[model samples]
Target: MKYLKNSTDTNYSMFLTNPEVICRKIGNGFFLLSSKKTWDKCPYVQQISETGAFYWNLLEKGIQRDEMLDCFLREYNIMREEASEDLDYYIDMLIEYHYLTKIE
Candidate 1:
Protein backbone atom coordinates (compact mmCIF):
# COMPACT_ATOMS: atom_id res chain seq x y z
CA MET A 1 0.00 0.00 0.00
CA LYS A 2 1.11 3.55 -0.66
CA TYR A 3 1.02 6.32 1.90
CA LEU A 4 1.26 10.05 1.65
CA LYS A 5 4.58 11.39 2.86
CA ASN A 6 2.84 14.34 4.52
CA SER A 7 -0.57 13.51 5.82
CA THR A 8 -2.80 16.27 7.17
CA ASP A 9 -2.71 16.86 10.93
CA THR A 10 -6.30 16.94 12.19
CA ASN A 11 -5.76 18.71 15.50
CA TYR A 12 -7.29 21.89 14.12
CA SER A 13 -9.79 21.65 11.29
CA MET A 14 -9.93 24.43 8.77
CA PHE A 15 -11.40 24.23 5.30
CA LEU A 16 -11.97 26.26 2.16
CA THR A 17 -14.96 28.41 1.49
CA ASN A 18 -17.85 27.13 -0.55
CA PRO A 19 -16.94 26.19 -4.11
CA GLU A 20 -19.38 28.68 -5.53
CA VAL A 21 -16.67 30.53 -7.37
CA ILE A 22 -14.73 29.15 -10.29
CA CYS A 23 -10.94 28.77 -10.18
CA ARG A 24 -8.22 28.10 -12.73
CA LYS A 25 -4.58 27.38 -12.16
CA ILE A 26 -1.93 29.53 -13.77
CA GLY A 27 1.74 28.88 -13.15
CA ASN A 28 2.32 28.85 -9.37
CA GLY A 29 -0.83 30.78 -8.49
CA PHE A 30 -4.58 30.66 -9.07
CA PHE A 31 -7.15 32.90 -10.66
CA LEU A 32 -10.48 33.20 -8.86
CA LEU A 33 -13.43 33.94 -11.08
CA SER A 34 -15.99 36.36 -9.70
CA SER A 35 -19.52 36.51 -10.95
CA LYS A 36 -20.79 39.68 -12.55
CA LYS A 37 -24.04 39.29 -10.66
CA THR A 38 -22.25 39.20 -7.33
CA TRP A 39 -20.22 42.35 -7.97
CA ASP A 40 -21.34 44.51 -10.83
CA LYS A 41 -18.21 46.67 -10.76
CA CYS A 42 -15.69 44.33 -9.24
CA PRO A 43 -13.01 42.76 -11.40
CA TYR A 44 -13.86 39.40 -12.91
CA VAL A 45 -10.57 37.83 -11.89
CA GLN A 46 -8.48 38.05 -8.72
CA GLN A 47 -4.86 37.11 -8.20
CA ILE A 48 -3.26 35.71 -5.05
CA SER A 49 0.28 35.29 -3.73
CA GLU A 50 2.30 32.06 -3.72
CA THR A 51 1.92 31.73 0.05
CA GLY A 52 -1.79 32.32 -0.36
CA ALA A 53 -1.88 29.59 -2.95
CA PHE A 54 -0.13 27.20 -0.57
CA TYR A 55 -2.66 27.85 2.17
CA TRP A 56 -5.50 27.68 -0.31
CA ASN A 57 -4.43 24.22 -1.38
CA LEU A 58 -4.13 23.10 2.20
CA LEU A 59 -7.59 24.46 2.92
CA GLU A 60 -8.85 22.23 0.12
CA LYS A 61 -8.25 19.19 2.32
CA GLY A 62 -8.57 20.93 5.68
CA ILE A 63 -5.48 21.58 7.79
CA GLN A 64 -4.42 22.29 11.34
CA ARG A 65 -2.66 25.37 12.67
CA ASP A 66 0.32 23.31 13.76
CA GLU A 67 0.54 21.75 10.32
CA MET A 68 0.75 25.20 8.79
CA LEU A 69 3.25 26.32 11.42
CA ASP A 70 5.40 23.32 10.57
CA CYS A 71 5.23 24.19 6.90
CA PHE A 72 6.45 27.73 7.52
CA LEU A 73 9.07 26.50 9.93
CA ARG A 74 10.41 24.09 7.29
CA GLU A 75 10.26 26.59 4.46
CA TYR A 76 11.99 29.36 6.39
CA ASN A 77 14.17 29.75 9.44
CA ILE A 78 11.90 32.27 11.13
CA MET A 79 11.29 32.20 14.87
CA ARG A 80 8.17 30.52 16.25
CA GLU A 81 6.53 33.84 17.05
CA GLU A 82 7.22 35.12 13.54
CA ALA A 83 5.84 31.96 12.03
CA SER A 84 2.69 32.23 14.15
CA GLU A 85 2.15 35.84 13.16
CA ASP A 86 2.63 35.08 9.49
CA LEU A 87 0.23 32.19 9.67
CA ASP A 88 -2.32 34.36 11.45
CA TYR A 89 -2.07 37.01 8.78
CA TYR A 90 -2.41 34.45 6.03
CA ILE A 91 -5.55 33.02 7.64
CA ASP A 92 -7.01 36.46 8.27
CA MET A 93 -6.61 37.43 4.64
CA LEU A 94 -8.20 34.24 3.48
CA ILE A 95 -11.06 34.73 5.90
CA GLU A 96 -11.55 38.30 4.80
CA TYR A 97 -11.78 37.21 1.19
CA HIS A 98 -14.21 34.44 2.14
CA TYR A 99 -11.71 31.89 0.88
CA LEU A 100 -11.32 29.96 4.10
CA THR A 101 -13.70 28.54 6.73
CA LYS A 102 -13.02 27.15 10.15
CA ILE A 103 -14.42 23.68 10.68
CA GLU A 104 -13.61 23.54 14.35
Candidate 2:
Protein backbone atom coordinates (compact mmCIF):
# COMPACT_ATOMS: atom_id res chain seq x y z
CA MET A 1 0.00 0.00 0.00
CA LYS A 2 2.91 2.35 0.74
CA TYR A 3 4.01 1.94 -2.85
CA LEU A 4 0.70 3.26 -4.13
CA LYS A 5 1.58 6.90 -3.63
CA ASN A 6 5.29 6.53 -4.19
CA SER A 7 4.77 4.83 -7.56
CA THR A 8 2.93 7.79 -9.09
CA ASP A 9 5.22 8.22 -12.11
CA THR A 10 5.64 4.47 -12.44
CA ASN A 11 3.30 2.11 -14.23
CA TYR A 12 1.92 0.91 -10.90
CA SER A 13 0.05 4.19 -10.34
CA MET A 14 -1.91 4.01 -13.59
CA PHE A 15 -5.66 3.32 -13.77
CA LEU A 16 -7.87 2.48 -16.72
CA THR A 17 -9.80 5.47 -18.03
CA ASN A 18 -11.16 4.32 -21.37
CA PRO A 19 -14.96 4.18 -21.56
CA GLU A 20 -15.46 3.68 -25.28
CA VAL A 21 -14.16 0.13 -25.14
CA ILE A 22 -16.60 -2.74 -25.06
CA CYS A 23 -15.99 -6.18 -23.60
CA ARG A 24 -18.09 -9.27 -24.11
CA LYS A 25 -17.72 -12.57 -22.33
CA ILE A 26 -17.52 -15.68 -24.42
CA GLY A 27 -16.70 -19.18 -23.13
CA ASN A 28 -14.99 -18.19 -19.92
CA GLY A 29 -12.93 -15.53 -21.77
CA PHE A 30 -13.69 -12.11 -23.14
CA PHE A 31 -13.21 -10.08 -26.32
CA LEU A 32 -12.71 -6.33 -26.33
CA LEU A 33 -14.06 -4.04 -29.02
CA SER A 34 -13.31 -0.39 -29.48
CA SER A 35 -15.64 2.18 -30.97
CA LYS A 36 -15.59 2.67 -34.76
CA LYS A 37 -13.66 5.89 -34.45
CA THR A 38 -11.02 4.12 -32.38
CA TRP A 39 -11.08 0.99 -34.53
CA ASP A 40 -9.24 2.56 -37.42
CA LYS A 41 -6.49 3.59 -35.09
CA CYS A 42 -6.35 0.26 -33.26
CA PRO A 43 -7.95 -2.33 -35.47
CA TYR A 44 -7.42 -5.56 -33.69
CA VAL A 45 -10.01 -7.00 -31.33
CA GLN A 46 -8.37 -8.30 -28.16
CA GLN A 47 -9.10 -11.67 -26.66
CA ILE A 48 -8.13 -11.88 -23.01
CA SER A 49 -7.41 -14.71 -20.59
CA GLU A 50 -9.54 -15.39 -17.51
CA THR A 51 -7.09 -13.52 -15.34
CA GLY A 52 -7.00 -10.71 -17.84
CA ALA A 53 -10.80 -10.64 -17.86
CA PHE A 54 -10.74 -10.25 -14.11
CA TYR A 55 -8.35 -7.34 -14.45
CA TRP A 56 -10.46 -5.84 -17.22
CA ASN A 57 -13.56 -6.03 -15.04
CA LEU A 58 -11.73 -4.13 -12.35
CA LEU A 59 -10.50 -1.56 -14.85
CA GLU A 60 -14.00 -1.03 -16.17
CA LYS A 61 -14.93 0.04 -12.66
CA GLY A 62 -11.91 2.39 -12.53
CA ILE A 63 -9.63 0.40 -10.21
CA GLN A 64 -6.11 1.34 -9.25
CA ARG A 65 -2.89 -0.71 -9.31
CA ASP A 66 -2.81 -1.38 -5.60
CA GLU A 67 -6.39 -2.63 -5.73
CA MET A 68 -5.28 -4.98 -8.51
CA LEU A 69 -2.53 -6.26 -6.26
CA ASP A 70 -5.01 -6.73 -3.42
CA CYS A 71 -7.35 -8.69 -5.64
CA PHE A 72 -4.49 -10.81 -6.92
CA LEU A 73 -3.42 -11.60 -3.38
CA ARG A 74 -6.96 -12.52 -2.40
CA GLU A 75 -7.61 -14.68 -5.45
CA TYR A 76 -4.22 -16.27 -6.08
CA ASN A 77 -1.40 -17.58 -3.94
CA ILE A 78 1.24 -15.56 -5.75
CA MET A 79 4.03 -13.38 -4.48
CA ARG A 80 3.62 -9.61 -4.47
CA GLU A 81 6.46 -9.16 -6.94
CA GLU A 82 4.95 -11.69 -9.31
CA ALA A 83 1.49 -10.13 -9.09
CA SER A 84 2.87 -6.66 -9.64
CA GLU A 85 4.93 -7.72 -12.61
CA ASP A 86 2.06 -9.51 -14.26
CA LEU A 87 -0.33 -6.64 -13.65
CA ASP A 88 2.19 -4.24 -15.14
CA TYR A 89 2.53 -6.29 -18.29
CA TYR A 90 -1.21 -6.76 -18.62
CA ILE A 91 -2.01 -3.12 -18.10
CA ASP A 92 0.74 -2.17 -20.51
CA MET A 93 -0.73 -4.40 -23.16
CA LEU A 94 -4.18 -2.90 -22.72
CA ILE A 95 -2.80 0.60 -22.83
CA GLU A 96 -0.63 -0.08 -25.84
CA TYR A 97 -3.64 -1.36 -27.74
CA HIS A 98 -5.88 1.58 -26.80
CA TYR A 99 -8.17 -0.76 -24.92
CA LEU A 100 -7.43 0.92 -21.62
CA THR A 101 -6.42 4.52 -21.06
CA LYS A 102 -3.83 5.32 -18.44
CA ILE A 103 -4.73 8.06 -16.02
CA GLU A 104 -1.97 10.48 -15.10
Candidate 3:
Protein backbone atom coordinates (compact mmCIF):
# COMPACT_ATOMS: atom_id res chain seq x y z
CA MET A 1 0.00 0.00 0.00
CA LYS A 2 2.79 2.41 0.75
CA TYR A 3 4.67 1.77 -2.44
CA LEU A 4 1.84 0.90 -4.77
CA LYS A 5 -1.58 2.52 -4.97
CA ASN A 6 -2.99 0.32 -7.77
CA SER A 7 -1.99 -1.68 -10.77
CA THR A 8 -2.79 1.09 -13.23
CA ASP A 9 -1.22 4.07 -11.49
CA THR A 10 1.07 4.69 -8.54
CA ASN A 11 2.36 7.50 -6.35
CA TYR A 12 5.76 6.03 -5.67
CA SER A 13 8.56 6.69 -8.10
CA MET A 14 11.13 4.07 -7.08
CA PHE A 15 12.22 1.79 -4.26
CA LEU A 16 15.40 2.52 -2.37
CA THR A 17 17.73 -0.44 -2.12
CA ASN A 18 19.29 -0.80 1.29
CA PRO A 19 23.03 -0.26 1.16
CA GLU A 20 23.52 -3.19 3.48
CA VAL A 21 21.46 -5.61 1.48
CA ILE A 22 23.34 -8.05 -0.72
CA CYS A 23 21.91 -10.33 -3.40
CA ARG A 24 23.42 -13.22 -5.32
CA LYS A 25 22.44 -15.79 -7.86
CA ILE A 26 22.61 -19.30 -6.49
CA GLY A 27 21.89 -21.89 -9.16
CA ASN A 28 18.35 -21.11 -10.29
CA GLY A 29 17.31 -19.06 -7.27
CA PHE A 30 18.65 -16.07 -5.39
CA PHE A 31 20.37 -15.62 -2.04
CA LEU A 32 19.58 -12.50 -0.09
CA LEU A 33 21.14 -11.23 3.10
CA SER A 34 22.05 -8.13 5.02
CA SER A 35 25.60 -6.86 5.27
CA LYS A 36 27.69 -6.12 8.38
CA LYS A 37 26.90 -2.45 8.04
CA THR A 38 23.30 -3.11 9.01
CA TRP A 39 22.64 -4.04 12.61
CA ASP A 40 19.04 -4.98 11.92
CA LYS A 41 17.86 -8.56 12.42
CA CYS A 42 18.01 -9.45 8.76
CA PRO A 43 18.57 -13.12 8.06
CA TYR A 44 21.98 -14.50 7.19
CA VAL A 45 20.61 -15.88 3.94
CA GLN A 46 17.06 -15.79 2.69
CA GLN A 47 16.47 -17.82 -0.40
CA ILE A 48 13.97 -16.61 -3.00
CA SER A 49 12.31 -18.07 -6.06
CA GLU A 50 13.44 -17.23 -9.59
CA THR A 51 10.33 -15.09 -10.11
CA GLY A 52 10.94 -13.31 -6.87
CA ALA A 53 14.56 -12.77 -7.86
CA PHE A 54 13.39 -11.28 -11.13
CA TYR A 55 11.32 -8.72 -9.32
CA TRP A 56 14.14 -8.13 -6.87
CA ASN A 57 16.41 -7.21 -9.73
CA LEU A 58 13.84 -4.74 -11.00
CA LEU A 59 13.57 -3.18 -7.59
CA GLU A 60 17.33 -3.10 -7.22
CA LYS A 61 17.48 -1.16 -10.46
CA GLY A 62 15.16 1.49 -8.94
CA ILE A 63 12.25 0.71 -11.25
CA GLN A 64 9.01 2.43 -10.36
CA ARG A 65 6.20 0.24 -9.03
CA ASP A 66 3.93 0.84 -12.01
CA GLU A 67 6.75 0.17 -14.40
CA MET A 68 7.50 -3.00 -12.54
CA LEU A 69 3.91 -4.05 -13.10
CA ASP A 70 4.29 -3.41 -16.79
CA CYS A 71 7.35 -5.59 -16.93
CA PHE A 72 5.62 -8.27 -14.93
CA LEU A 73 2.67 -8.27 -17.24
CA ARG A 74 4.91 -8.66 -20.24
CA GLU A 75 7.15 -11.31 -18.73
CA TYR A 76 4.36 -13.54 -17.43
CA ASN A 77 1.24 -14.75 -19.17
CA ILE A 78 -0.98 -14.43 -16.10
CA MET A 79 -4.03 -12.23 -15.97
CA ARG A 80 -3.55 -8.61 -14.97
CA GLU A 81 -5.58 -9.03 -11.81
CA GLU A 82 -3.52 -12.01 -10.77
CA ALA A 83 -0.28 -10.27 -11.61
CA SER A 84 -1.34 -7.18 -9.68
CA GLU A 85 -2.26 -9.20 -6.64
CA ASP A 86 0.98 -11.15 -6.75
CA LEU A 87 3.09 -8.03 -7.15
CA ASP A 88 1.26 -6.25 -4.33
CA TYR A 89 1.85 -9.17 -2.01
CA TYR A 90 5.54 -9.42 -2.90
CA ILE A 91 6.12 -5.70 -2.49
CA ASP A 92 4.30 -5.72 0.83
CA MET A 93 6.43 -8.60 2.06
CA LEU A 94 9.65 -6.87 1.01
CA ILE A 95 8.57 -3.71 2.79
CA GLU A 96 7.85 -5.66 5.95
CA TYR A 97 11.22 -7.41 5.82
CA HIS A 98 13.05 -4.08 5.35
CA TYR A 99 14.48 -5.41 2.13
CA LEU A 100 13.18 -2.41 0.21
CA THR A 101 12.14 1.16 1.03
CA LYS A 102 9.36 2.98 -0.79
CA ILE A 103 9.70 6.50 -2.15
CA GLU A 104 7.14 8.91 -3.46
Could you tell me every candidate's TM-score relative to the true structure? 0.59, 0.76, 0.78
What is candidate 3's lDDT per residue for 1-104, written digit by digit as tens?
Answer: 12334343434344566767778897777888788666464566789877788788877776766778788888888888787788878877776777777665
- Cα lDDT computed for each candidate against the true fold: 0.58, 0.68, 0.71
Clashing pairs in 3: none
Can you list the residue pairs that collide in candidate 2?
Answer: none
Top candidate by lDDT: 3
Between candidates 1 and 2, the one scoring higher on TM-score is 2
Clashes per prediction?
0, 0, 0
Question: Least accurate stretch of 10 residues (summed lDDT) in model 3?
Answer: 1-10
Residue 14 CA displacement from its true place in model 2, Å: 5.2
CA RMSD of all predictions: 6.8, 4.0, 3.5
Collision count of model 3: 0
Q: Which residue pairs come into collision in candidate 1?
A: none
Scanning candidate 1 in windows of ten residues, the lowest lDDT window is: 1-10
Q: Which candidate gets the maximum TM-score versus the true structure?
A: 3
TM-score of predicted structure 3: 0.78
Per-residue lDDT of 37 in model 3 = 65
lDDT of 1 at 66: 66
Alpha-carbon runs more than 4 Å astray in model 2: 1-16
